[model samples]
Target: MLLYHTIALAAGYLLDLLIGDPRWLYHPVCLIGNLITLLEKGIRKIFPKTEKGELFGGFLEVILVCLISLGVPCAVLSTLYRYMPLAGLVLETFWCYQLLATKSLKDESMKVYDRLKNGTIEEARYAVSMIVGRDTSELTEEGVTKAAVETVAENSSDGVIAPMLYMALGGAPLMFLYKGINTMDSMLGYKNDRYLYFGRCAAKLDDLANYIPARISGWLMVAAAFLTGMDGKNAVKIYKRDRRNHASPNSAQTEAAVAGALRVQLAGNAYYFGKLYEKPTIGDKLREVEPEDIRRANRLLYGASVLSVLLCLGGRLLVQFLV
Candidate 1:
């Protein structure tokens, strides 16, 4: 079983690299998002619009979402494996491919780069807005580039390494469970008026889920910098120096490493939902971020992802051998 899962993980990573999330297929995350929305609406109807009610509703939401996410896949995979083990492996590999976003992340960031390289500032902003949470309507070229680069750096952990870690540890069901928590966070985990109380559980859960994976991603990225001939020493230095720069404990880990690797500053003030947010800068201003940095960041992300796969598979295999 352990060997089967290890092979499934590698196969899934290769599948994601070859073909990213296709529009035609039904993605599990989309289903999970819909379930969250429906449950949120139903919970709101059942509970009063008060702090205590919201808290209870939020907890219920987490419980229901996690159960469905973990349970459905486990049931299906178990039945399938009982009937046909090979078919089960194939289905599980497909699920793993669906959960990862490595190729999609790279492609989207490059789209922003393409727009900026062609001098289409509006198009660049539009492309970047698809990936980042910040408002990009009034950003400069450098701002757009920085946003794309920063997103690539940060999501290298969230979208790729984190999921891979979960999948390696517990296979497909657990990976989907992590995705469920992440999707909930993305949808409702905000400090804004609407979600301040309603989304608190989801937000805290996401932070807790990502805590270790984020730090591991930071170090993996630093090692990737070293392997890729970037400034690995500076990557480690900046990562330690600025790892705590973000309000979210995990967001700045890879951002700091990538910034130091490239010797460019990232994460100053940025507007979100039409309001300017004052954020501390990460990395030194040794060089200004340019359009090319987007591609460079993608390279770093890909390198880190590859390294993560090796380590996860290697570690799992070693443990299996020892056992």
Candidate 2:
């Protein structure tokens, strides 16, 4: 069974590297997101508009989403594995492929890079808006570039490494659970008035889910920086010094490493939902960020992703040996 899982994981990683999430295919995350939206609305109506009520509702949402996210995949894989092991392997491989966002992350960030290289400032802003959660209306060229770079950096953990780790530990089912937690946080984990209470549970769960994987991503990024001919020593320095610079515990881990590797300032303050968020900058501002930094960030992302695969497989092998 473990051998089959190994084959599935390797095949899935290759599939993701070759072709990322296509726009035409209906993604599982879409279903997860819709479920969250529906449940949020229902919870708002059923639960009273109070702190405790919202908290309980949020907790309920967390439980329900995670269960369904994990359960459905488990059921499908179990039934298939029982009757047709090869078919089960194929489905699990595809599910693992869908869960990873390496090429897709690079593709989306490159959209901003391409626009910045050949289009108007407004066009560049619009390109970046598709990838980041921050406002884009007033971002300067450098701001836009940094935002794109930061998205690649932060998501190196969330969109790639964390999911990869989860999938390796428990295959597609557990990864779905991680994605459920992540999707909930992405949707509801805001510090705004509307979600400050209602989204607290989801946000905290995401923080916990990403905790180890985020640290592993930070170190892997540092290693990748060296391998990719970036400033690796600085990557380590900045990672250690500023890994906790963000409001979210996991977000800054890889961002600090990338910032140091690139020697550019990132994460200084940004606007979200028509409001300002005062955030401390990560890394030293040794140079101005350029459009080229986006490419460099993607290179680092790919490097870290490869390292994550090796590490996960190595761990699995060691565990099998011990068992």
Deviating ranges (above 4 Å) for candidate 2: none
Candidate 2 lDDT, 1-323, residue by residue in tens: 67667777888999999999999999999999999999999989999989999899999999999999999999999899899999999999999999999999999999999999998999999999998888999999999999999999999998999998998899899999999999999999987778999999999999999999999999999999999999999999999999999888889999999999999999999998898989999999999999999999999999999999999899888877887
Cα lDDT tens digits, model 1, 233-264, are 99999999999999999999999999999999
Per-candidate TM vs. native? 0.98, 0.98
Clashes of 2: 0
In angstroms, the error of model 1 at 293 is 0.5
lDDT, candidate 2, residue 37?
99
**Quality of model 2 by C-alpha lDDT:** 0.94
lDDT of 1: 0.94
Query: What lDDT does the true structure give each of the candidates?
Result: 0.94, 0.94
Candidate 2: pairs in clash: none
TM-score of 1: 0.98
Query: Which residue pairs in model 1 clash with each other?
Result: none
